[model samples]
Target: MEDEKNRTGPLMIALQYNDLFDLDSISASTNTEDALPKGRAVAFVKAVQTVNERLVEQNKSESLLFEVILIAKECSEEIKMKIVESVKYYGLEIGKFFFFKKEELINTLQSNKVKLFLSTDRDDVCEALHTGIPAALLYEQSDDHVLSQLKVIFSGDVIGFSEDSLDSLSDFGFSETQIETLKAAKICMKEFAVLIGQMKRRFGQENSPLCICVLTAWGSTNVCVSALKTLREWGLDVDEAFCLAGAPCSPILAVIKPHIIWDGGLHNMRDLSAHS
Candidate 1:
């Protein structure tokens, strides 16, 4: 993956396993481990089911390739469904995940500080692009300039405007309603992932109870509203709540239902990851 050593630039830590296929073997031995919803797991694993056949042509013996394929597929399923699901239940969209052709993505993290994969399309890359310092790569390339790949870059910081900068809003073709929604989210949220880093540095790696408060947007989605209600019931000790979305609405954030929603929320989380 991109150069993870330098903290200044966009660094992606792409974890590729060595010669051990032990995890893969462990997967086939059990069926009770489930952490993600079935749909996500199926979609994730089915992605490369088409390519497994090609493994036969890798010039490796059939027995070796078959074992590798089995292990790979089993590990893939365990991660998307079981691992991600478990973390989601814990109120953290946080975990280690698999990525095909992870080396290419790591290459971007080197000097670019931003991972822009110019080559090697991996099925799992889509998961990688959606998070971690606004990373992305080409899906289908084209000659169009305005609609180029660089568009994926986090240029929102470049405008030096409020979250609702009309010009930036215009770039995405978001309607007036969409712009308002994002603003409400920002107001209620006091910190982002970047802020979380600061806190960790300030406090060090220690665990302590936190006092949280949420401000609701005027037109908050029902899910958001329901979530707040749920938080209160769960003894979150919410200090304050406000309306920023415009009207009384809440979001269905429970879909990513986590046991302990982070103080910063999962709005800018990376993707389906897991622990060892």
Candidate 2:
């Protein structure tokens, strides 16, 4: 990629994708990149995620980072010949930080040039980026349930169960502390939504630029869901809320959604809660 492609925004690094489901798009091959038997969705998603980490490390610089994936696996298998070229992304970052280390990660992205990184070794990639070198990683996103949850959260969509209230969502796996923060944020989100509504009435209907809170982890679902509903009811484009959350059960939590996806920052939630 060119130096300009690596440029950055005031608080964001640029991310570019060559293919939505193209594996060859990335230099890393079969072993490193996630491969799919019937769907290129996994590979495409992995490449996009790798690009995200790089963007975080690049931060506001004039550097643009491009992450590509090889997605023609199934087509090749069918015809017994390769048909390269396919990739996609939900590009853009800095909507919200729900995870603690994410700030550290973003801090790393701001100064260094992380060329690419994979989502599979998320913890490991994050560790390597500490050196301030442009890097890359790959990952795949599947599992409809988790993806659904992520999609809803990233889109700022409300996750409402048929039950009026969840007796316990421990199946999602979250620490007690995270749950508490989600609860408080949930209540606050209701008020926040009302303010957002008033903003819409004053400014007219357009959410190109809006401040939002993100919640990560199942522990955060209660408050996060409440907040989302409130925003929708009050009339803020909640899908544009740009909140954050961190629960590492599934690979692609919120990315499948339309909103700008963020890695949730639960441990980091303290700083935000303290301020509130």
Candidate 3:
């Protein structure tokens, strides 16, 4: 009943939980009307726990720099209540909730100072990214794989950078078409890089539940090397860097068992839910 718009404190991670589940499927899967944890919410719950535990152990709990917020588009009261109940059932303690029209999403996120916006809807994620906030389209977790750590993979396209001041990536053996692809991806990755850097500083890279990686089809290309170098200069280096050199990364992704994979194409977020 209280106004949640004015709620402010530590920066937050906003989750658009509406698209995270197939409501019809969930209803069919369960016999009761009570909201049940299904889909990626299960994996997300564990991931959040892992992060919280790491923060507590490192004695960084007090600062509480990042909190979780839940956002959903306006729906019937019945559906809204179901969402609230389901979130609580999953043990994802939300600091605030926003039920707004789709058009208000960016304003809501920016007003709340959300550092990252995550959603199963690709359009929603892309919309958020255009607002200059780091956003990722998450696939549904197909299996109930209990995650001990929140493994993350960033497509090399998103992490790589070719400064205009320097020559284009094409000068470094990349084709003119490939260079065009890089240009399109530049802005989103720049903002995302900063967000990841903050996480590394807060959580401490070694022995942490947050595993960051870069997996690209670029293989061992010169531009790929430059990408890592640029990330290092930004004071952030991925824990693992894989250059598949045009190989289908599905196999590699299955082995890594990442909870979230950020692709430059954005919409191409694979269904990695099958593997842990």
Candidate 4:
């Protein structure tokens, strides 16, 4: 009974689906090199297998859970078969797999005892961290060093490493321009929050309906138009909307109390609102 009290919980690993198979083909199809290269893939497989083998040697194999997450929207049957074959080659079972579209990875993380997410995509790592899961990058140069880092991360002795950190943002493939835009977005978001707070105070209610104003920068006219269409479809009332194109920025900035000020990336906003 005393030994049981000192035992650690099961270890659950969530691997990126594309990382298990041939990365070259997957990259060509997706137009992204965020897939694990052959050498790195073999190394990761060996590392996981080695850990599990050690567990088995110590009579602790029962405390391991492995899973793969399908981040791609569609994969060919042949490609999938190859993935299965590769997992089999590593002696890892293929029964534990989930499609991102069908299920949220956060759900699995919440239910598991100990969770670690591995992926070549920085966006995936960011998402996992956002949901409070420990994640590691499976880069082309991954080796024993990366594996050792994972062990340290899973041990819960680390903190202050977040998606917003410079290293993490860079790993997620954010360019300097993109990072600047995000910083601006954060300031704008805070402004929106303040505006919303003032509106609530004036209305004397927490659920006051807000009049949102959306403006697009010069190159984002098409995105704003799509957002308008989606907003109309959703029956959301928009007080004002416009594309900056050739217009002076001063006029748009002069607007004092728009509850929510959305600028650029309207297409993504539209899709998110539609789904919600």
Candidate 5:
């Protein structure tokens, strides 16, 4: 069946592995044994439905793969069963859902060829990234946004730009000399870039359901220009680019309401999540 789908066309085929969401991202944190999927559960369901619908509209037979992985220190059978039931109730169609220990996560992810891993927990995200997985810390959304359109925002630092340059840019104080030095630094493609490239390849750049945006802290300075040029040099062009120049991103984020935001540090995610 997979082979048949691949034969349809380049854009019509499914990605080998797409998104993997941690249980915490979909569920509410609680002390109870049966913590059913909550918070972003509905949004996740909508995202899957939208992606499948878009694929069908383009005359594709395969659906975008969405997996829900649970990594627990100790998860009983009853709790696991309850989680399965809750996922069904929420109508979140998962391609592969399983529970694993912390030690088993890297191997599991490798064997499955998971492209992008997302979790609301900082530690889980950090672990995945540390193991060389394309991972991002997802923030919980309470407001209504366009779930059909999966909007993802990435910081310049997350894209593997110069750290020192980004720090200066965020401070709203960067001279031409600093900007030139940043541009001189050899910036290689990071895991996040690889994920973006995969998406672009799977759906074609113009037809992809993803609305990729770059929300850089450089604002509108020359440093911002250099950073953007670096992104292009790395073969990435996002749908939207924001040069905030050290301003609060809450207002801009509230307007865009991206489904996920990727940054270089957990602190960045925490700060954005707090303000968003």
Candidate 6:
């Protein structure tokens, strides 16, 4: 009884349905090997329900509450409804089963209710980890291993799991040429980190926050945006935000005054008052 009391509670699992089930060519007439079958979907739902039932039978429901969240992106509402109905048939309560779109995912994952995130998308896993959520990747190899890995995520042993190479630009839906352009224009994370450190050291205590001018091409826009979010996260007050057209030699410039500037791209920390 004491050992049972010390056991970990049930994990709240957020499953990205697109990863677990194939939706590449889901259509009424298109029944290919890659298409997710209705029978398989039902079986998956029932398997999860069985786990919950076993916990309840052992009187461990209070210690652990198994919940499943389904996230569907680029799928029709009809598909979403069908999936939801299938899960409901397996005795999954309305509150325990949730469906969300790509846009709604961040907020849902940030919620304290979700304990672990499971996805096949590398970007999704990264997003979850960035927001301080534990995430695991679902592969088609083995169900037993995947289930065990989910528990590992809940235990906080693994923060993110993805075997795929991460192409941020591509994952964000940029075309092949655009991805190459973005890769060339984008500032590396190390450079961004250094810039953030410089900001914290320089204008971190200024009465008026420093204004940032982000000048970059369209392909590198995400880099600038991520930089802004990172700045805010560091508790720095960003006075103004501007996106300039054309790619400047320097990706990020700090406008200390009308004339004074700090160039992050060059790592130039000198007072530019002489040039002004």
Which candidate should be chosen as best, given TM-score against the real structure?
3
Model 6: CA > 4 A from native: 1-10, 28-48, 60-63, 88-101, 142-276
lDDT (0-100) at residue 142 of candidate 1?
Answer: 18
Model 4, 274: alpha-carbon shift in Å? 44
Give the C-alpha miss distance for residue 167 in model 1, angstroms: 7.2
Candidate 4 on 207-226: residue-level lDDT in tens? 33333454544324454565
Could you give the candidate ranking by TM-score, starting with the highest? Answer: 3, 5, 6, 4, 2, 1
lDDT of 4 at 72: 36
Candidate order by decreasing lDDT: 3, 5, 4, 6, 2, 1
Candidate 4 lDDT (Cα, 0 to 1): 0.41
lDDT digits (tens) for residues 177-272 of candidate 5? 444333332221343453344444457667577677777663344545555676666545677888776678789987887776665343323232
Candidate 1 stretches greater than 4 Å from native: 1-160, 167-172, 192-198, 203-276
Candidate achieving higher TM-score, 5 or 6 = 5
Per-candidate local distance difference test: 0.28, 0.33, 0.63, 0.41, 0.52, 0.40
Give the lDDT of residue 162 in candidate 3.
47
Per-residue lDDT of candidate 1, residues 204-224 (tens digit): 222211123343332224434
**TM values, all candidates:** 0.20, 0.27, 0.76, 0.41, 0.64, 0.42
TM-score of 6: 0.42
Worst-scoring 10-residue span by lDDT in model 5: 9-18
**Which candidate, 1 or 2, has the higher lDDT?**
2
| Cα lDDT, model 1, residue 163 | 50
Per-residue lDDT of candidate 3, residues 1-276 (tens digit): 122233233546788765544565664457557664465655765686677666667764434445778787777687778777877776766778788997898999889877667777777765665556667756466546777777777766445544561234444454544344434445556555655555566665566777878876643455467667777766566789887766676788778778666764434322221100
Q: For model 2, where is the 10-residue window of minimal lDDT?
A: 80-89
